[model samples]
Target: MRSPDQRLTSEAKVTAQSMLLDPSNASTNPVENWRACFPEIIGRSPAMIAALETAAKVARSDSSVLIMGESGSGKELFASAIHRLSHRSPQPYIPLNCAAIPENLLESELFGHERGAFTGADKRRIGKFEAASKGTLFLDEIGDMPLALQSKLLRVLQDKKFAPLGGNDLKEADVRVIAATHMNLEAAVQRKSFREDLFYRLNVLPVFVPSLRERSEDIPQMLEHFTEITNSNHSAPSVSFFTDAAIRMLCKYSWPGNVRQLQNLVERMVVLKGGGAISIDDIPSDIIRSIEGQKEQAIVSTGADFQPNFQQASSAMPLAIGGRKQIAIPDQFGVLPEAGIDLTSFIEGLENGLILQALERTNNNRNQAAKLLGLNRTTLVERIKKRRLAVLNEPSKEL
Candidate 1:
């Protein structure tokens, strides 16, 4: 049965995302297949495997663990693996997304209350702490937890006990703590946004998950796994895979959003293309833009990549603009200070800097530089444009 929240999003953009909740409903992907591809609990990367080994070592010990990583990076999986490998595997494993709970209700949710403790308490209940007694309680996205609750959580971790929202008595739980976050606690500490003592308590046994870009070598395997799972969900008789060309394009693109973005892309492609292959044409315009931008970046990287103040200019640039509005380019935006001085020399120097960068980008090849600069080779020669840029000081060569 669909929940009320699920029904509310029935016409939203993520209808298909919900459909993917039960891939086995369509086809049973051999657990071994996924395990073989992704292989490790978190991943097959060396750092991740080392993390697993460390987690296994600590699994038997009755100590709190903190799994840290960026969003979409698998932190809960590590928590579950820890619980499964532990002696308390027979008990329940409770996973809570702390950010999902409302601030007012968090106290009630974490610690059970008497039948008449609060207004919503129509009957007695077992809180997450009691429910996960003798097991693990995985707290996901703990960074967003309110400061007031942090004290209580710290108390729970320290004494393994907590009082219900409205009760005067205290309850004890044997649940092991496993907290996860995408936030930088050290920075939060400096900013006084996070409780220093709570941060220290949860800082034990920290496991940091590497970003996808750091281990891009694993992307191919991840994509293959996601594609197959998607195909299975679609009731496809055979496995779906990206074509070599499509895979090439995917490899070329920089995944800023990491694995989650890749998963979303694969799901979108499967729904829209309805085949075992994802073609370049099937890729969305933004994805194509990312790939093309990477290619252009490679060319620009040879010389004009930075051009000084590029990042500052980029920060100043708007995310969206009117189709007809020609927003100022980096050159126009990097003008001199507000001082009423001869801005001509500064502008000319900036132009020269850009020109030099363009020349170096083409490796002192005059014709290529001219084309890159949107000028004819003859025009460049007539102007005696400097072809010897610092990035490449070789003599100019014709196209």
Candidate 2:
């Protein structure tokens, strides 16, 4: 019998071949062929799968799409996928970062400029809108777009037409607009920094990409994917495997920089280790310290009889998720009753408080809260249900 790894690889190859045979499978249900077509976008988490499905559905329409996610969470990848899967795939897919470009040049960059429009305008320049006509224009970091530019953008979206700088003729825009931002546009709108009209115009179809911590279960796969990429790009030797302890430590890390951070770490590891097996020592010291801190906190919070046998536990439980080993203890305790204390009620209340705090830190985003508490979404929900705590602004209880 083939080993599990070999079997998995064989199955993946078969699936890829089948997808190639039926090209229509991608258009009809792109999510089904997500791994085959979008290898750069990696995640098997329910949160990610849902976001991709929504993107695929919206890709069929020409309506605007607003992608919300933390920095380095691959918003551009989703935007590109939408453009590629859309009817305008034959046309250009232009991307311009509103934050990267200067405010003065941004207007001309989006609306073009005629000769002698400004000091640097030596000749007629085609802006993003004109260049992306009949295609897609991805406005990344749209929240950082100047208020003046937002008005012009709103006009273009509204009328499907725009005039170049220092030009009288109005050019028709047949392009779809896909805006992405790491900022909270709603908050920006409330603060009068981002235009309200522009926010509504871009938010026709919103797709929220969950942060890396929200989908830590996919870390192993992502590490492998990045490893392969690093090897192929640098022509390094193939990485055999990552030690289970190393994988667990990585999975438990709070990736503040999201997917991009993980990719960078993987590249560094491949180069440093020369594509050999990655052991726990090979991981960065900060990551190791973070994992250790979390483990220590978990033990202290539970108040359970904890032993420092992590290495033995890791070796024994090679597949333990998040590097945590659960030890069950009998519910026996010495009771001192001057005034009777309800231990059950106190413990329950403490648990509820922690859950609420986690929810608050994550802005009531359950997936993120679950990660914060080191529990899966289902377990988190069950805890919430048991405690009967009211959570406001709970974004779509699904996953």
Candidate 3:
């Protein structure tokens, strides 16, 4: 029998491992506890929190999960989180990108081949399904899976058994599947490119991850997190920080490529700036141009000529949008004092003021406010959410 000290040491090690790996030990808050399960997913926005909650609830079930999100929005990360939070976490978590493989070799890659299964099949090879038995298999870009493979995959999910190529024997598949897709599978099904049956089977538990722009409030935190991670990964002396002005400017960006693009930008900045305060001046010209382009469009939408230079703002400038009342410019307007006005900030402030006024006029009715602002309800709601305005009511309630 082992000594008491040895047994105690063993127990302590186990406890420590459990403490680090178990999500329950992370926090007292249920949402935070779930968030702890996904350490790599950085966001506290309501949309992200909702997604985490859904993922946490579904993680306990053995049903197949379908993660839907735009490319680079971290659909695969969500899949991994689901696997990690599942009973199959101790087992392997294999990921395969259906879009990355060729149609000829994709089947063999998913379901291994026996010796001489095909021209290149010289030896028996394990496939993702067999390799992930008793664990989780993440099929990324599953919408891109060929129709032929989709039928076979559906069969495996249904029968829990698959046969290898050139082999008569069937192997048991005790795998939990988590599929992710940026494509609209419903549309693909209508287009006859994707199997409708497979889509429904995998979509038993659907989790929609919000894009970066939908949760822009998380950008500052994400930026800081990315900066620290990049600094540590690159062995920088210290972590870099973005200036408040720089962060505000970045928050204005649409982030079309989402989290991946932000992560790449953080790495680029850490490498280029050598770990220091990153100001708006340090921001890439393309990013600035993108923001400027948006502002130019907003200006044009107001029936005003696009003014590239803020300093050249004409006095008594008339602004009209969708037959709205024209703003009466003051004589002192556009005249810069010793401290020149930040036109971008001024425009944003004006926009917010108008939105607030519209909401008030409509008695916090988002749809009516949107109509008053000459914007669609969806666009208005998005703006309100981005600005964190809690005054608006549900779009369903007109009054």
Top-scoring candidate (lDDT) = 3
lDDT of 3 at 77: 78
| Whole-model Cα lDDT of every candidate shown, in order | 0.61, 0.71, 0.72
Write model 3 residue lDDT over 1-399, tens digit each, in one string. 111122223443343235445655555666665555466578988889988888877888999998877667888878876776677767888999999999999999999999998997889998999999898888998987988899999999999999988888999999999998776565456457889789889989888888786799999998899888888888667668899999999998867677888989988998788878999999999778777766654221222211111111111121222343333232223544222333443554457557766776677787888989899999988866654444334443574
lDDT of 2: 0.71
- Candidate 1 ranges beyond 4 A from true positions: 1-42, 236-239, 298-399
Reference-based TM-score of each model? 0.63, 0.69, 0.69
List model 1 lDDT by residue over 1-399, tens digit each.
111222222332122222233334322433322232222343566555555556655666767887765556677666776665566766878877888999887777788777888777888876889888887888887877899889989988988778776677877778888898766555355456789899889877666666564566667777788887788899755556788787777776556455777888898788677775677777788768755655553222121222122111121221111122222232213433122212332343345455655665666677887788888878765433222222233356663
Mark the regions of model 2 whose C-alpha exceeds 4 Å error after superposition: 1-39, 237-240, 298-399
Instruction: Give candidate 3 regions above 4 Å deviation.
Output: 1-30, 235-239, 298-399
